[model samples]
Target: MDSSLVMIGLTNVLSFNNIACILGGTLLGLFVGAMPGLSATMALALLLPLTFSFDPATGLSMLASLYVGASYGGSIAAILLRTPGTPSAAATVLDGFPLSQQGRAGEALGVSLFASFFGGLMSGIALLTAAPLLGTLVLEFGPVELFAIAVLGITIIGSLAQGSVISGLLSGGLGLLLSTVGMDLTTGTPRMTFDQINLFGGIDFTVALIGLFSVPQALTLIENSHQGGKVASRITDRLMPRWSTIKQLMPNILRSSGIGIVVGLIPGTGGDTASWFAYNEAKRFAKDKSRFGKGEVAGVAAPEAANNAVVGGALIPTIALGIPGSSSTAILLGALMVQGILPGPNLLTDYGDVTYTLIWAVILANIALLVVGLAFTKMSVSVTKIPDGFIACAILTLCIIGAFAINNSLFDVGLMLGFGLFGYWMSKAGVSPAPMVIGLILGPVMETSFQQSMLIGNDSFGVFLESPIATVLLILALLSILQATPFFRWLRVPFKRRLKPD
Candidate 1:
């Protein structure tokens, strides 16, 4: 709040170089985001090396710009090509692709861009206002509260798991196990390192992120090439929806933003979960709910707003605590550390300039994304014309570089390739990588917090209910599980029938 710090932040962000960096990052994000298989996490991984040369504030501001831009950029391809540029855009494609088929692609894309901008702007303002308050709350958190938060996050993974809840839990449990690979935190005993010197430092989250997201995409591209696959993008003439259309969708936009913020505040929940929840809620409330799957404008707007708003909302927990809100932010934590900046309660008190700069960066990036997205609509369509082989090779190159750059480990490269195969198989089996990503990112916090809380409770099972927050969270977790069960749905049917006096 000091005048000097505010002045410094404005100066740093307003400088020619930083402005150029933001624009460059946004453009790169938009392009990478429009291409299926090239995710925001991978794009950030590729850009990580470039940040080593800049000042911490400048570098992080640029990265944040790219992060926001790319999340919104994914919707372009989801609408135009019927393929999600990133997994979070999957909900966008439900109505977006159909809009394209109906020759309203331009209007759909335009609405998406505007809704994304508004949602991001709203969330950015929310971050600016909410971060400090949340940071204060973070000061009150200990192992008990932290553990409660982690469990809450894990519960939201249900929204993204897609397949059997059991499988999702298994994948998440495996990730938690993998997170314990390094030496024990309190005790110095090495746990899962196998005495390998490289593993003594633990698996680099960035390397795992790149490997998990990018390599599998590369392999998919190659496999498709051999099968004579084709991809195409088309831009129709209509560029804007009617005023009536906008009026009809306003309610959905607001509702989706609310869902995005709430879900994003939970550590493991991400843009995909926000979008999915928003889409479902929209269907639930719509007058003609059956039209949801038939290219309704509200369908397109709901997820677009939700996903974009998630960029700002996700930052809340990451900045207030050390936990990441999504996979992309998990890599961002490493980036923050690389710049000698740690993400925690002190971020606002100690580094308000950087924090606010990042908030402004989100807003600025959203504006840039809209302009760039609109101007290049036709050119982006040309992406579909690229040879599948070349795209495959290019992605492979990025994956290799991305893996190696994380701690400069050759072992990570092999790890990336191994995970690549595993991811491909998982995709075929209808399993979601998102739950695993969240599990991997939040595993250490969950395990360590659980253990510490238990020790403090003297092995008493009732100890978990000592804190009101803990008690409430555990109850909510049970409710979430029950709500997702078939028996609960069946039970609700009778209640609804009685209420309606049938």
Candidate 2:
């Protein structure tokens, strides 16, 4: 990295116009993310078109700020209303709402905000340093390796199912099937379009995301409208935690942040996965595990830090390899393409200044999140006070608008509604939508890479197993599958017993 180039990028990020854009974007993100049925990805998708009018640096910075802010903002609703504003904050609801009910809403919010800030700061540092190194490493990867990695990601996610692993696999298989609905990329022949032109382009991801995540929540809200008062009372304490409490939770925050960064670096995984993994790890390692899910401050800190940290980590692959680590970063990649910037190895070499500026923007966004988030904590509590019916109607309206806005097509709107109904049913069946989402995103990559690898190897199946990286990834995938089985759990019990000291 050139020192002069780095300084130039920092200078650009610190400019008044760029700072204003970041601030504005962060504020918008906080509002959107604090509302149930809205997600960071949907927010970015809706906002991407507006960035076309701005300079590249300003536009990208704004998106980065929004990503950072939304990652943290989800906790507000999760804490106050027992509903996560974003899927990434789902784990936060386990402890956050408990704390709110205990009349410690301020304490939970403060810890969440601070942990989010710290995690994002650490991830920004990781993005600044680790991305370049990882970029070089990925240079050694072939299509076979990439395909293997995608398979590994899907396997890991499916195996981590909170309910039946079969259900998770079934959901993932369904997504993979849906991913094949469009025309074949290689043959240019329709597979499952059924004569619909819109189907030729495949289902729009944003439409599916909105329908799957937002619609179900809206329906839930509407169904529960008659039974609810405000989930919690007004919050009226300081919005910052005491220094002593911060010091005590620092270790858990740091550990969870590390977990989040690793998860975020893997393409197809997102903050939701990171938060759940962090929450589980925190519970496993805590001295007082009994406190978890009953308003343990550490419980709130773990997921908040992990989810926020995902913002910077997810950006790493998006910037360096053109592989989006999560849905929000996928939208950021779209924003880059709209600005005529192509991501991959050439991104750093041809657009070093812009790349570095985006990295710096991540750091700046976290700082702004800390400042702006604390300022709004008191006011945001009022969100829970809104009537459930009113909230449901507002969200349904936004969902309609957002779905239609993607391509200005009523067909997309219909698709969203159909998927929304499907999603609601899936939820009712106790199946998670996360594995399906991962399968949907990675299915194309895996298919394309596998075909390309076969072509490169003259139709030889051994090509996939030949690469050392691919081999290792496949082994890990196998292990992940085995780990999800009851037999593996039984086997592990004895090993754990043997390892324990008498």
Candidate 3:
């Protein structure tokens, strides 16, 4: 807020070299994020050493732009291939690929691009103006509240299921079970590693993500080609969505941005949580719920906005409190450390010029994402039309390479193949993998918070009930579960009327 520092910051980032850094890093991030298994964290890590040559402010600006660009890039793969290019893109696959299948790939890409821009811009504004206010909020969330949040996040699997509620529950439970495969965080004992060193860290989420989504689709493409399924040709639909379409999706995009900010501000959760949460809320708010996962633009809009918004939201805590909100932000924090800029409450004060340059860079990068996406989204439609045979091979190679890249372990690759088979079977059984994926994501947060809360309360279950916020969240979670039942749907719950005859 200091005028002198603000002016210095503006001047630093606006320089031609820094602007070029923003553009180049954004382009690099876009390509990296569009590849399955590669992540923003990975890309930033690779780019970190190169920043040593640039001025501190300029180097920070480039990294910030890459972070913003990668947030939008993951949606590209989700739209084209039914595979999440990054973990945060998982929810995008639900609606994006469906629209692509319907030959509306260009429109889907456009919606995702604009939604990401809106969300990222909003998040950047919040970071610029409300960092201190939002940072204070971090203190209010104790372990109990976090556990409640995780519980609420888990319950949304019912909303994501979209087909059979029971099947969704089963899938979510399976995810929770799989999440326990890692070492026991509390006792320092292995729970389900099964004597395999690779299992010591549990399954890498990316490996599972690539295998479950990417491999199954690849295999399916092969099967469809063998069965003589029609291969769609390259589409040439207009990439720029009509103004009317943007107007209709604006509300969903706005709401999803808020969700992303809240979720990202929390230290442990990330964009993946925000995206899925936004997707569920969008479905909950829809007038025609059945349209979800079947080419609905709102479905694409909500997740894209939320996930991209998370980049800005996650940075608030990292900048204001020095607590990294997520892994990508943590790596960004590392970049600051490399430049001798330590993170803490005094971070902005000690290095106001450079820090503010980072903040402004995120805003500028979102604008860059819009420009690049508009020009490239239409061209990206080609990926949706690759011949089935070649597409199948490409997907398989990418998934395998991605899985192996996690730790250079053949075991991870084999695990990915195994999950691919399982995911294929789950698809046949009418079970949605989204819920299971949600379960895997929320499980650690739930387990850790619950255990920590129990320790604080001397093993009393009353600890969860003591907090008003936790109590309300638990009730909402319960409501989510109850509403998913056949009885509630049949009765229509709150709207059911008493018999007039009485």
What ranking emerges by lDDT with the best candidate at the front?
A: 2, 3, 1
The total of clashing pairs for model 2 equals 0
Which candidate should be chosen as best, given TM-score against the real structure?
1
lDDT per residue as tens, model 1, 391-464: 87987887787677666778988887877778777778887666676666667777778789889988776777
Most lDDT-accurate candidate: 2
Better of 1 and 3 by lDDT: 3
Output the lDDT of residue 22, model 2. 90
Residues 390-425 of candidate 2: C-alpha lDDT, one tens digit per residue: 877877788788778778899999998998899899
Candidate 3 structure quality by residue, lDDT tens digits, 1-502: 6668767877888999989999888876787677555567656645665665678888888888888888888888788777677789999999888888888888888899899999999999999887656444545677888788667656654444546767877877888889899799798789888898878887766566666666666676677665443333244576788999999999999999999998888654678889999999999999999999898999999999999999889888777755566657756765776677755545667677887899889999999889887876556544434456776787677677766665778998899899889988987777766667656655776788899999988999999899998899799878878887888887874455554334
For model 2, the local distance difference test gives: 0.82
Question: What TM-score do all the candidates reach, one by one?
Answer: 0.82, 0.81, 0.60
Question: Could you tell which candidate, 1 or 2, scores higher by lDDT?
Answer: 2
What's the number of clashes in each of the models?
Answer: 0, 0, 0
Clashing pairs in 1: none
Summing lDDT over every window of 10 consecutive residues in candidate 1, give the lowest-scoring window. 227-236
